[model samples]
Target: MIKKALKTAFPYSIPILTGFLFLGISYGIYMRALGFSAAYPIFMSMLIFAGSMEFVTASMLLGGFNPIGAALLTLMVNARHIFYGITMVSKYKNVGKKKWYLIFGMCDESFSINCSVEVPEGVDKGWFYFWVTLLNQSYWVLGATCGALLGSLVTFDSKGLEFVMTALFVVIFLDNWLKEKNYFSSLLGLGISLVCLVVFGAEKFLVPAMCMIFIVLSLARPHPEKEVA
Candidate 1:
């Protein structure tokens, strides 16, 4: 069952594998440049799993200790997962013992694929989701470990590596947009985000944008009674 599920899950994960490896390696190198040990990235990749937040965390760690501030920042940066969890509750509810890890390992890539891709007939959905999450995390861990170990030995310009995460997200968004028929949500999000960016500036726009998007999407969803009528 695991083997079969792994086979089914791997192809969906290939794009993520490529992106995570490059970004994860870049993260490790960044940590090393910050005077951190390889163990830092390895553990952070395993524990945090949120790419953007992990990068933010590197800077947080460099600064003075402030648990309350770090906690608030982490929540703000990862607030989107609240929406992801809501969307996934039904799909993941029946996954039995694997549900815990599924929730823990639900990174952006895993969520994108699992939320969108339909599982094939005869494949165990639980195992399929599990394999996808595990594989993605493994790629991140492997890349971070490699980068941290090799960071000291390598010598070259490391500028612009931070943009890898943004690039990966753009690819994911475009892929989903192409597959989707209804452009309302995409356009709405983009429009709201742009408005928020202009109004609030990049430093303060995220939370307000997320709140508005959630409210708009919730109100926009069609009612079952209306559909029945």
Candidate 2:
């Protein structure tokens, strides 16, 4: 069962493998450039596992030691995961102990694939979810370790490497947009986020945007009676 799950999950994670390697390596290199040892990136990749937050954390570490600031920033940056978690509650409910790891490892890529991809006949859903999450994190950890180890040996321009993550997000959004039959949710989210961005400005928009999106989505969800009719 585990073998079948791993085999089934690997292909789905290929895109994430490529993206995480480049981005993760870039993160490691960034940490190295910031004078952090390899252990920093390796452990951060293993534990934090949040690409964006990990990058932010490096900056925070260099700036000063403020646990309050770090905690708040982490919540703001990852507030969207709240929605991801809510959406996943039903799917992850009956997965047994694997549910805990599934929640912990529910990075954007893992959530995206697991949320959307259907399990094939005879494959264990729980194991498939577990393998996907494990594989994705493994790729990230390997990439971070590699880049950190190589950081001293190789020197080149990494000026624009940060944009790789943004590019990956764009690709993921487009892929989902194309696959979705209902554009209302997508349009609403994009519109609300844009409005919030303009109103709150780049530095302070995310949390407000997420809050509004949640409120609006909850109201927009059709009632059971409406769906039945």
TM-score of predicted structure 1: 0.88
Clashes of each: 0, 0
Q: Across residues 168-218, which tens digit of lDDT does each residue of candidate 2 receive?
A: 567667888999999888888889989999999988888998888888888
lDDT of each: 0.89, 0.88
- The true-versus-predicted C-alpha distance at residue 197 of model 2, in Å, is 2.9
Best prediction by lDDT = 1
Distance from true location, Cα of 82 in model 1, Å: 0.3
TM-score for each model:
0.88, 0.88
Tens digit of lDDT per residue, candidate 1, span 85-144? 998999997889999999999888889879888899999999999999999999999989
